[model samples]
Target chain A: MDLRVRELIKKIRTDKNITFLLALVAVGVFVAQIVYYVQKGEVFSLKRGFQALFLSVTLFLLFAVLQRITKTGKPFDKTIVTLLRVMAVVVIVGGVLPSCVEVFVVVIRGGIYTIDIANLDIFVPVLGVMIGIFSEIFSYGNDLQEDNDMIA
Target chain B: MAIIVRLDRMMADRKISLNELAERVGMSNVNLSNLKTGKMKGIRFETLDSICDVLDCQPGDILEHQ
Candidate 1:
């Protein structure tokens, strides 16, 4: 490969893929537990199967990528930094992607009913959840940094 | 990761122990440990001054640009 191509590949590899993957895994395991319990320990029904497959693939792919990033050691930051980045992405994507997808699927299936999408109160709650998670994760990073400083 | 902690070497050449230097510089043992281990991102001018005074050497002896 050319030098630029190699550099690009290196960057791609260094991206905090572990965080992504772990986040995926967190969401996956959470959903899996719910589904398993809901379905009486059987992952059979179409809805349960769909949930399982979606969560499993998403978690596995994302977590695997993140795990690779953590293993590279080229990023050269504290483990805390790496973990925080991973946690934030995991938390955000964990909460948003599935909900958004589900909402889109439901809306599309239901057709544009009399539900006034314009006057909807949906965005505020979602934004609040995102912000809450973001703040918690941001503080978590700071705490981790302080812990590292103490350790050092 | 290849940080060179010249503090130990300089102290050794001057026949100084870490405790003696830390006491002379009026720094806590913990902070001194951090400096000696190259865990310090920076040293204040006051700290450098104190260290230089105690070591009887210029800042150049303690810090070398890599």
Candidate 2:
């Protein structure tokens, strides 16, 4: 590999750990959000609560898998790329859809109902897409490496 | 993938076993097998050089464009 490509790979390998740590922090924040709602005597619906928990766990596991991919040194493995894509779908379903549902509920109920949107709601799924694209790039890299190895 | 590997034929003509060729070429059996079967995506010049030396054959004798 050239120096620049090697540098990029090194950067990705180092950054995955940070992504995993951020996912862990997200779990804590989600838990805290639930605790805050409870303390305020707010009606935290069971459905939304479950959704939040599921999203939190998915985020954590996605990053965990990414960390493991970097560790395995085979980011282009078809299985891992498929996993990253699957997690992207999970984020859209488990993370983004619930937020959209909350907004939809307020819309259908007319002017009396309201639900606030936090920046985190937008950020998490966007992060998921970014991670998904990163995996795709790695998958392509793997193919290139294979071609280099076999072309002697 | 379009390029073909004739390493197996060359080795066969020399009456060399896969293990013997691999041992002389300093490559593992699996990798050598991959090359022989055209499963390899690429080959290193060093490996090619070693194989050519071991089999007393030119690169053109072992690899050909399809």
Candidate 3:
């Protein structure tokens, strides 16, 4: 058909591939967590394994929705941006909640001095904040794209 | 809010259809429609030139400062 349409399709495919790579990373993190639990001979209980799995799943779902947004060719849609922001908030809160609870429990039980810094708790919060930063960048880009689209 | 495109009136005076003008201007019908309805925030100089050439009118004839 049209040259512009062909270029648009190519761009969408590229975006899909990027999202797929991100999803793959999320899966790798999930699998790595499983391996860590297995190596430690842990029972993989809900408390320990569930948080890792939840974070990875949230990341995967975020990328999936982003891919769909690119496919729909409405990147500047306000509702999509809002959904992305909400998911980022969910990821940030979910990633930090467990660690906050752990710290609270330690303080309550008079074990605050025994807090370990070698745990994975720090990484999750950073990752979640990085996702939040990306979400904000995307939100700004959406506003700019919407303005561009309004130009004749 | 100040700039207005009087394309519809010019097209009426020139007896030219939207489709014919769009083809001559080398732009899509939807884009031309948006421009005509003042929904667009800006217009390119190239498009303005093409439109003026096709309509045999000056830029001021089609654009107005309201």
Tens digit of per-residue lDDT, candidate 3, span B1-66 = 899999999999999999999999998899899999998999888999999999999999999998
> By DockQ thresholds, what CAPRI class is model 3?
medium
- Residue B59 miss distance in model 1 (angstroms): 0.6
Residue by residue across A18-124, what tens digits does model 2's lDDT show? 76676667666667766765676333442365466656667666666666555665556766776777777776567666556555555665634444545355766
Best by lDDT: 3
Candidate 1 clash figure, as a count: 8
Flag regions of model 1 displaced more than 4 Å. A1-114, A125-152, B1-5, B26-31, B37-41
| Error of model 2, residue A15, in angstroms | 11
| Best-matching candidate per TM-score | 3
TM-score of chain B of each: 0.87, 0.95, 0.97
DockQ of each: 0.07, 0.53, 0.70
lDDT of 3 by residue, A65-121 (tens): 656665666655666666666676777777777566555655665664355668656
lDDT of each: 0.59, 0.72, 0.73
Candidate 1 overall lDDT versus native: 0.59
Candidate 2 regions off by >4 Å? A1-54, A63-73, A93-95, A101-111, A114-121, A145-152, B1-4, B13-15, B64-66
Better of 1 and 3 by DockQ: 3
Clashes by residue pair, model 2: A149-B42, A150-B41, A150-B42, A150-B43, A151-B41, A151-B42, A151-B43, A152-B42, A152-B43
